[model samples]
Structure formats: structure tokens, C-alpha cells
Target: MRQDKPELRNLSEPVRFKRALALLLMTLVLPGSAQIVAGSKKAGRYAWRVIAGLVAIVVFLVLLSLVWRSGTINLIVSPTTLRIVQVLLILLAVGWAALFVDAYRLGRPLTLERNHRLTASILDGVLVVLVMTVLIWSSTIVSAQRDFVASVFGNGEKSKADKGRYNVLLLGGDSGANRIGVRPDSLTLASIDAETGRTVLIGLPRNMAKVPFPAGTEMAKQFPNGFEWDGCGHDCYLNGVYTWAMGHKQHFPGVKEPGLVATQQAVEGLTGLKVNYYVLIDIAGFQHLLDAVGGITVDVGKKVPIGGIGGPIKGYIKPGKDQHLDGYHAMWFARSRAGASDYERMTRQKCVMTAMLNQLSPQKVLTKFQGIASASKEVVQTNIPSGELGTFTDLALDSKKLPVSSFSPVPPLIKTGDPDFELIRAKVAEAVGKSEALDKGSDDGDGKKSGTPSSVSPTKKPSTPGKTPSKPSTDVDDVAQVCKA
Candidate 1:
């Protein structure tokens, strides 16, 4: 009689119902979730490695879904999303830490019952899965950001035509803890012509001052000198203008207020040409990009001394025509400011860009694809629409079929008292051609007033050697006169 009493049913009626309900929900949820959670079983059993693999797979699937669904970038994680994700992760980690501490102290002998071990285990699993899901989503957001950033273009009209012709403003951002603010270490305009498949590069001197910016009160502070602009005196730093434009009212305006957009506008305003796009990359990222591209071969063209602003940073570039450069040294060459003018730096920047473009074969850096993409992701800000990336790639490929000749808008010619902005404006107009130039100025490079030309030659090369070569004269003009002219 003692042994034969039928074994009691395992669960009470209420408990049974609860368990059944939970099981039903799990069956609905966990098939999809567990598949994501379990991942594929591999040979290795390192816990961390397994977790990382699972995370990677999940992120990949999510991103692939976004790409597939949108066919272009339509989903962008707002700045708010990043903050929420970060805060949530940190809070979860803290809560888990507290639980771990409590378990260590109270659950003596690590028995299963007193602390409800099964319950704790379920909580841990659920939290981990939630964390993993969030992390995967976060990573998807980052990838989307990079792909979209690299694909956008600002030249509204140019983009509409589906031509390769685009404008890019390259800003070398100066970031530091104690500095007054971020400044553009370098500023340059890049023009890619789809029909001609030619790339025209122009560099702007950082110290060139008195450029127009919207005053803080005008037209809701349109730009140039609005609330977004943050520089002392009249004109803001070329790079600061971008920071102001994108997220002037807000600290981080996600990617919408990327400096490139404002730069495209400013360049358009100043130069009278529609900029197709813009790219802002930090010095560190630039170095990485250069290294990732196996460095670049540059023809120095003149003696480049490696020292700057009183020699705190030191390196030497010997006088030579062409030399191979690694990442570190190449940066020094491109950013060197010691015993040099902005014009010289501009020259170096163009050289680096040209060399990079010539050697920018995706095949060579396939192994470092992630690094390249990551570097671009962290540092670059642009307006290249994701939809146009394929078209851009095709255009770049087609460009290789044609010859690329390096050219610049003629340096403004000015009298001792007159500034050369109008002259510069004229050169800019000539650079983009009549139909493309935005602000057709009075001077057209030909010593005549209101003249227009297809292009301007800064110097004329002598056909014969040893004869006194004839060329345009560059008379010394005061900085003020040069700026205003």
C-alpha cells in the first residue's frame, strides 16, 4: 500500500496551466529567436568566440535584410537610438553585475533551490539574448551609416542627371580636448565630370579670410555666420562651417547635418558651382585609408621639408620628384605646415588624393575591407546617397579609360590694393565651364572685365628648353588685397 500509491501528477493544476501557457509563447517566439541564439555549432568551443560568431551572424542577417528591403538607405538610426542603445547596454551590464554579486554571497554551497536557480538561469538567458539582439541591431545601424555615407551626393542637380559628375568637399577635421574648437586642417573641392569622366581637384587655403557666412541673426542664420558657425572674428574656420551647418542647434544631429552638406552649399555660394557631394575625414582616418590603399606614390614636384609650427612634429621629406610613401609618412607630407603656405599644403593634398585615386583598386585591399570600411565609417561624413553608389562606381571605372589632367583655378591676379575674390570667382566659373559655373564673376582669366573662359592656365610651359620662358607674372600682393581681390 505504501509503495503502490499512484505517483502524484508532477505539476499542480494551476502550475500546469501556467507552464503550458509559457511553453506556447516560447514555441511561438523561440523558434525564430533560438535559431538566432543557437547559431551554427562549430568545432571551436571557446565561449567568447562562440558568442562573437553568433553576434556576427545575427548582425549580417539584419543588415542584409535592410539592404534587401530598402534597395537604398531608408533606415538610419537616429542619434537618439545610439544613446538609448548605449545606456541600455550599460544598465544591463550593471544589473547583471549586481545579480552576480548577490548570487555569490547568498547562494552558499551553490545549491539549486534556495535562490531559485532555474529562475535565475532563465533571467540570465533572457537578458543575454536581449543584449545580443540589441548589439546586433546596433551594428546593423553602423554598417548602414557607412554604406549610406559613402553613397550620398550633395550636388542636387548633378545627382538628378545620373551622371558621374559630382562635387566633394574634403575637410581634414581637427579634434582635440583642450583646443578652442574643431578646425579644418585642410579644405579642398573635388569635381568629377560624368560625361568627360574627368576629376578636377581644387584646394582652399585655410587662412583665406573674410569669406561670407550668414550672420547669427540673418535669415534664421542661413550659414557662413549663423549660430552654426563658430569662429572668432568675422569668418569661421572652413571646417567649423560644416559642424555648424549639420548640427548647429544640436550637438550630434545624427548624420543629417554632416559637414559635407554645408560645405557643398558654402562652396557653391563662394565658387559659383554646384557641388555634387562632400566628404569630411579626420587625419587619423585619412592615414588609415592611405595605408589601407598600400600608401600612394607621389611626385613631390618640389622640396618638402618635414617640420611645422615651430618643429613640435618633426620629419623630413627629401627634395625629389617622386617617392613611395607609407601611411605615417604620407600624412606628414600631406599635412606638413612648417615653412610652407596653405597653397603648398593644398598641392600635397591634391597629390595624395590623385595618387590614391590612381591606386584605388578594391581588389588590392580586399583583405582589409572591414578595416577600410570601419575607418571610413568612424571618420567620414558625407552626403553621397546610397542609391547612387553603383552609378558612381561605374563612373569611376569609366573614368579610367580617359586621361586625367591635373589643373587648378588660376590664383587671383590683383593689384596691390585690390583683393582677388572676384578674380578667384572668375577662375572658379572657368573651372566648371559656363553652364556649370554658379557665380559667374566679372573677370574671366583673360585680362578683360566680365570675361568668361572654359578654363584658366596658371602657368604656361615653354615648348623649347633653355630659352627664357614666358609666363603670367605673380606680383606680390598684401594678404588683405589678395583676399578681397
Candidate 2:
């Protein structure tokens, strides 16, 4: 009885085709959009597409602004990381657009089934949880980085100094189990004179004679109320002296004991300058820091020998006038005991430190954040507050053009026949800038008296004519006082 309406039937196919294409586009976009419902259900669903277009414009503007500003966003952070994050945001945006369209098209509920809303909600919640977790971790790392920077720049007496004036105590150690509680292998006092724009590094010999604590300190006076070292003939190691000097033993548990105080006093008496601050770095850290800044280039004076029982682990570093050294080989070369003298080691250390200074380029600074962080975190232990840390970082970053001079105390301060105490005092006074008649007592522009030993103190034992040299002083016992000063 009923005949098919040919016109109506013919129109259905093209309409279905259009709807299918639109649905496909919506599917592609809605997973990243917020849901929206309005207008004629079918026609209004396109509203999400319009919203997405607007969102795309906003994001474009933001990115353009970031590029224009040229901050860490443009220079420091990894481009690949930025790209991935951007892509995710784009995908999420697209997903939301699709979600919005689907919501609009579906009317009351956003699902194929009548009661599938709960499942959809669960999936959305899961996605949110994942996204938030990632954001949290990202935020934590970013904040940590910011905090580190802040620590370096914050204002405080400890951090206040002219742009060019600064001091750093450099400590080198074997860090081996046997070497534990022993003397540090190398010690250098580095000073940047703002007036002259020159850097001076004075390397100290490990066997320098000194007491661990001075007469007044309670610890020194109380030892056995102490017995004579002549009985044992055992000299305290340099590191032990530093430990006692800083009073680290009393404040930091397990570091306190008898011998440590003696070590502190010895270093003080030798240097004639109060030690303000120190940074202790081991062989591993030195190598890692070098690699972090890319390999360093050093001028090898001659073929440095390697390998021997008494020498630092053996290997031959070919003689060369100049060469690029990677971390591992560099360490071997720096700690090489081939010549077996502190002077030889000091020369190597200078070459390496100088090379490292030259290689600390801005390109590396921005690109090697992870490596730098790893290196610094592992090796650098200091009481310098976070605020002052930022200032020092800025200074170091700007110190590329500064002229640096390095010397071992042998010729002038530690000649073979020089009295041991005089050598120690001369070197300390030299490093403290008091030995220079002109610079004596002059304010370093910071209300405090110039050449005042920051906080380092030393004590020394009487020299035994023929016995092995006494151990260096330990300052760890006075650590809190020194740091506070």
C-alpha cells in the first residue's frame, strides 16, 4: 500500500556522509576539551571547534611571548622537553574539544549507553590523577632549582663582598677507605682580589707541621689532660686536624675525639691566617665536575709518569705541551705521583683547575644543568647558606675574564732550610694578604678589617728532628664557630 519516496531516500545518504565526517573530526578533537552543550544539538556541537580555535590562538600568543622574552624557557630548558610538553598540551586540548562536542551531541548524558556516565567519570579521574602527579614532580624539581639559585644570591654578611673579592678553600682527597681519617692529599687557598682583578692560589703541602688545637681551647688542654706524642711517634693526619679545627667533632657526632683537636691547632699555627671556609672534593667529584663542563684542556708540561705502589694508581699520560683530557685520565694526571712531590702535584692541580675555569662557558652552563647538579651534589659539602650561594654562583659565572695566578709555597715561603713555623706563618700571612705591607690593615671595603683570618685557626706540635713529619691540624672541632664567624 505504501510506495517509497525516492527524493527523501536519496537525500539520506549524503546527510549520513556529512554527519560521519563531522563525527570523525569531533572524535579527533574532543578528548582534550571541556564539555559544552547549547544551541541546536546537531549544529551547536560545532561550538567546541570554534572554542578550540580560540584556545589555539591564546596558546600561540603565549609561546610567542616566551620566545620574545628569551628566558630559561628559550635558552636553558631542553628544547625536546619543551616540545614534548607542548605536544601533550595540544593533544589534551584536542581531546577536550572532542569531549565538548560529544557532550553537546549526546544531549543529557555523554555516552552510548544509558548508564555509562560512571565509567566515563572514572576514566576522567584517572587521567587527572596521572597528569597531576607528573605536574607535582616537575614542580618539585623546578622549585629546587630556583631555591638553589636563591641561596647563592641572598643578602647576608657571610655573602657580602665586593664583586671581585672572594675566598675559597680547596681540598683534594684520595677518599679511599685507607685514606679515611687521614690527611687531605691537597689543600689550596684561592683568593680573588677585587682591587687588582687578580686571583691568587696558594697550594699548601700536606706534611706541613702544626698542632691540632691551640693552648686555650678546652679540648687541647684536656687530652690525658694529654700525654707526649714522643711515646707513640704517630703523627695525626691533615684531615683529622681540619676536623678538629672546625670543632666538627663536638657538634657533629662521631667526629669528636682526642687527636682531632691537635690537628686543628697545627693548621692554624702553620697558616698564620684564620681559615674562613673550605670545600672538600674527592677524585670522583673532580672528574664528574670536569665532564659536566665538557672535557678540560690543559698544557701538559712534560710526560707525567703514572703507576707505582706509592704513586696514585698507575697509567702513562703521554707527554704533551697541550692536550684535552677527559675526566678519568685527567684525574690520573692530576693526582699522578710519578714525580712524587707535593710541588709536582700542585702544578698539575693548577693546570686542571685553570682549565676547568676556562671551560665553564655559558653554553655549558645552560645545557649541563643535570650534569652540574649531579657533580655539585655529590662532591660539594659546605655550610654556606643558600642565599650567599647564589651570589657566589653569579660571581663565578662572571669570573671568566678574571686573571688567575697560582703558586706553590716552596720557593719563597717554604724553602728547604726555612724554619717550619716561619714557612707556615709566611704562607698563611701571604694568603691572608697581611704579608703585603701595603694591603695590611686596609678594609676590604666591607667594614671588617682586611686580612683578618676569616675563622681558620691552627695549632702545631714541636718538630722531632728525625721523625716523620707531624700530621696537619684538624679544624672540625671549631666548625660551628668558624661558620658562624
Candidate 3:
């Protein structure tokens, strides 16, 4: 009987160790399961209830998203909701970690063998780390979304598309401390077809003078003869509209973004397209954004200088077919005007945009989401509402498959200094018509001839004066091809 008793004790030690290990694993899988099996019933019940509530909330959010995606996105992106979610994630991490520790305790780990006890400690450490990592990651994403919402979106009435196309004016400028005010050095109108996602990039020159405003508007009333008013002699240029309007803010009563508003009006009047929204990007901040996305690759057509106008010359980006550019180098590549004209700089900027659109793949975006989100908030400002973001996102994805075409009103096409509005409208109409036909041809599966222009070649230099501009040399053969190289 004495020998049997010792044997039974030995057997019971192994059984206890196995039970403890089982309970710890169960708790790891289902937060309250181990507690219910071995620990206090009351604690297990509370944890189960909390888990159930979280699951219910998630299910409800999913359903809501399916029914009304825009509303759900707006609610999620709201600053208040982001803060609440961040706090909840932190609380969840703490609560989950505590439950894990309790699960280890319920297993009676202290009574196990030395090896078993060490194993339990290791398991406990892993559980805490894994749970906390997920919660913290979610919290960081929420914070980034909040900052993006607050910095980028502005309180502006959303405008409807005109003739099945949404025209968005994109402005890029240097907002450095040395600059007097925001002077939009580069302006491009991204006119996207609502259904087909066909895009036409319309580039406008910065030094273009005599810019007209939409008739019957306050700006038109102020400058009936164009942006060149009585006092504004040489300062009345297309890019100067923003700074000029800002200086005369009293003229635009009850307007929040008078500068952008004025610029939009000017672009709309020039392009003969109704402008729906505007996105302003600070050139300096754009560098940081590029760095966040691991930089971008572009085809450098010519030798571009780096930092010469204001500061000393830093370096030069040598001409190459496929050049990978970091943030600093990329900024100079887009903005440098040392030996190049503004027209050439405009083309380079368009190339940069094309590269970004094509090269910023989904994998890169997901991996570098945090950095990208934070940098975007600093560099970008727009009146695009949070509610419409999903729709635009879908359109942007659709556009990737379609070819992008560009039209610039520079020399050999349309004179920028004294542009003929009628001629500009005709060119815009022709470009849009060709894009629509191409998209239609693609949809019809006509592989032989998809309405794509043979004259469009990215490598062709602009035709000199006296030559017929029937097919200007400064046309994009395939924006995708240029970007991919």
C-alpha cells in the first residue's frame, strides 16, 4: 500500500502538468475558456461577455459598411471616433494581457515541474507580445487616419461632375519661408471620366498672363478685363491668382479658402471645364512623402540640376533611362529650373506623377502605410470630402488599366502669354473625344485599332514655330510606358 501511494502521487504530478498546459492553450485561443475550466467562474464570465461584445460590434460595423460605405468611412475617419478607437485598443491590450496572465495562474503553473514552469512562462510572454502588437498596430493606424482627416480635408461644399467628367485642379508650389506667399508654380487639371476612368492631364503655364475668370462671379467683377487689373502690370500671371486673391481677401467675403477658390475659378475659365475640387501640395513637404514610400523611379530624359536658384547648387541628376530617385533628388528633379524652361519642368512633373501612380503598388502602400499616411497629411491639402474618398479610390484603380493622355497649352500648341480661349476649348474637346473613343474601343475588344493616336510619342521634342502643330511633338505616346521605364 505504501509503494502504491508514492506511485499514485507521481502519476498525479504528470496529470496536473498536462491539465495546466491544456488550460493555458485554451485561454490563448479563447480568452475566457481556460478560466472557466480551471480558474474563477465569475472572471471567466466577464471576459466571455467582453469578447462577445467586441465580436458583435465588429459584425455590426461590417454590415453597416456594406449598406452605406461612405457614411461608415466618414464615421471611422472622424477625429473623435479615431481617438475613441485608439483608447479602446489600448484598453483591449491591457485587458487581454491581464486575462493571459490569469490563465497562466489558473493552470497552477507554480506547482508544475521546473521544465513545465519555464515553458508556461515562455508561452505567457508570447501571448502578451502578440496581443499587444496587434492592438498597438490598430491604434497607430487610427491615429494616422485622424491626422490625415484633420490636415487634408477642408470645409467646402462638394461639387457635382460636369458632363460625366470630374475636373480636379492640382497645384504644386514651394511654400518655403523664403517665399512671400503660396505661388503655384505648377498647375495641372486631372479631368477623369466618371464611368470609363479615362484621364486627360491639362498642363498650364505659370507665367501665362491675362487669365480670365468665370463671368458673373465676384472675381470677374473685380477683373472684368482679366486678372491684370489697373495696378497689376507684370504681376498678373496665371500662378499669381492665388497670392493676388489672398492679398485682397476683403473682396471675397465669407470664403474660407479664397486663394484656392480664385485659382479654381481661373482654371475653370481657362480650360472650359467645370472644376470640382483642388489639391494643393507643398513642394518641400512632397520630398518627405516620397521618402515614406521608399522613393520613386523615373526616366530622366535630360541632365537636371539640383538647388541653384535660391541656394548653392547641390548636385545634378544625370540623364538616364531608368533612374531611381530618393526624396531629395526627386524634389530637384521635379522643381529644378536651372537650365530648363518652365515648360520642360512641367513635363518632368507630369512624368513624376505618372511614376507615382504606377509604381506606388498596393504592397508598398500596405507595408509603408504609417509613414505614407503621416507624410501625406503634412504635404497635401484638399477640399475632397472623406465621404467621396472610396468612390475616387475605385476610379483611381480603374484608371491604372487605361492609357493617360496629356495636353499642354505651351508653345507650338497654344500660346501661353496670350492664349485664345476658343482654341484652348477646341483642343480640350478633341483630347477628351479621343480618350473616350479609345476607352470605347478597348471595351469592344478591338485589339487591332483601339483609337490610340500614333502621333503621341513621349520622347518627341516640341515642334518649333513655323511647323504645323497638326500633331504636336510634345504629346504623350503612352503615359504608362513613360512611367514604367
Per-model TM against the reference: 0.53, 0.54, 0.84
Where model 1 places Cα greater than 4 Å from the true spot, the runs are 1-164, 213-240, 243-261, 301-307, 405-419, 434-485
TM-score of 2: 0.54
Q: Which ten contiguous residues of candidate 2 have the minimum total lDDT?
A: 476-485
lDDT of model 1 at residue 22? 43
Q: Model 2, range 1-485, lDDT digits (tens) per residue?
A: 43324643454544533433344344334432222222245434465565577689668757864554223233323334444554555555445444544433432232234334444444444444554555554544444455433332222236333333555667775656665443467777666553433455666666543333455665455332232244323333344455443544454345433333343344444454444445667775677877777776665545666655564535577755447777777877777765556566765676567667767776776667656766766666554444344344444554556544443446344542233555455554544343222333344554433454434322223322221111222211111111110
Query: Can you tell me which runs of candidate 3 are displaced by over 4 Å?
Result: 1-15, 40-75, 229-234, 440-477
Compared to the true structure, candidate 1 yields what TM-score?
A: 0.53
Assess the local accuracy of residue 256 in candidate 1 as a C-alpha lDDT between 0 and 100. Answer: 52
Superposing all C-alpha atoms, what RMSD in Å does each candidate have to the true structure? 14.5, 13.2, 5.8
lDDT computed for candidate 2: 0.48
What is the lDDT of every predicted structure here? 0.49, 0.48, 0.77
Best by TM-score: 3
- Residue 390 displacement (Å), model 1: 1.0
Candidate 3 lDDT trough over 10 residues, lowest sum:
464-473
- lDDT tens readout by residue for model 3, 252-341: 998876889999989988878899988899998899999999888877766788988767888899876668999989888888988778
